[model samples]
Target: MSAEDATQGLGIDALLERERAKLDRLTPARAAAAVELQGALLVDIRYAALRERDGLIPGALVVERNELEWRMDPTGDHRAAETTDHDRLVVVVCNEGYASSLAARSLHALGLHRATDVIGGFQAWAAAGLPVTGAPNAPDGRA
Candidate 1:
């Protein structure tokens, strides 16, 4: 079926809900712990504009949304060094968590079964007092 036909009646909200249902989404704090304690790879999928404007999560792999599958597929030639195994946990983060759900679902389709997203994305991470760089009054107390 055509892409339009497959999504004939489903709006973005419905599609996001369906995608999220397949994931065990993580909150900002939990996501941070997963990275710090469990070796989970936190991937920032927000575009360059957003990253520049809102700052970034320190140590999170900055992968463009369009390049995610290529960079994240463990067996792909272009895969990031961190994409070493299918069993590795990958936590996706977007601007506000919406796109991350869909991105995580796509990772699942690529056999990354442990892929999931941050519940409120980078905004939540920053709000939860997690580390961020380049943001106003950053975690390090930098302006």
Candidate 2:
């Protein structure tokens, strides 16, 4: 089948479901623990405005969604310091989680087999009482 034929009936929701199923998506608490104890890298891909509005996880790497592939590709010259190897566990986070799943899938395409996304994204993290900084506007002002 042609490329267009392959996706002829697949809408964005279906596509999102398919991509999420291929990942071992993490909960907010588990994601925090993985980053804190298991050496996992939590990457935040939320745009600047959302990040500014929602605050940020203490150590999550902030890379734009457009730059995610290059910045997190372990073998790429533009890789981040934490983009150590293909085996590293990469947990991608977006504003509410949808984009992160797709982003993780892209990382997998780049040979990063361990890439995944948080189930509920940054909003979930903040709701779960996880640490957030610079969020003066947060409901409880966790900043």
Candidate 3:
């Protein structure tokens, strides 16, 4: 935690609250429906090990959390082909959902007004009976 901050030197929880406050996060079921009906782009930002161990959402784009902003920034040289639209509804996913909120906020900074994160992440999706493929070391999802 940093000292002398405006937030009274609060830690990650406070940071998470601030980030989430800026978003309209979606539940897993709604997130899946958003992709199918609202044209939302679901992004999975988990690392290789966790993803391989748990599995992946069927159609979510695999982009590591660290490079998210660059890949989704339309003006960036390495931006993903699917992220060209500033109005695209981006739904970022992390292992449990915390990091995805931060990722979505970064996307908003790049003029992506429709950016948001999954409420409970991949686990929630699986719990909600959403489609997922690949298993631990299954050699199916992106490495």
Measured by lDDT, the strongest candidate is 2
> What tens digits encode model 1's per-residue C-alpha lDDT throughout 51-78?
8877889899999999999999999999
Judging by TM-score, tell me the better candidate of 1 and 2: 2
lDDT per residue (tens digit) for residues 76-137 in model 3? 89999988789989999998899899889989999999999998888787767677777654
Ranking by lDDT: 2, 1, 3
Whole-model Cα lDDT of every candidate shown, in order: 0.91, 0.92, 0.86
lDDT of 2 by residue, 42-129 (tens): 9999999988877988989999999999999888999999999999999999988999999999999999999999998998988888
Error of 2 at 38 (Å): 0.6
Preferred candidate (lDDT higher): 2 or 3:
2
TM-score of 1: 0.90
- How accurate locally is residue 90 in candidate 1, as Cα lDDT from 0 to 100? 97
Give candidate 1's error at residue 126 in angstroms: 0.8
Model 1 stretches astray by more than 4 angstroms: 1-7, 136-143
lDDT of 1 at 111: 97
Q: Clash pairs of candidate 3?
A: none
| Cα lDDT, model 2, residue 99 | 97
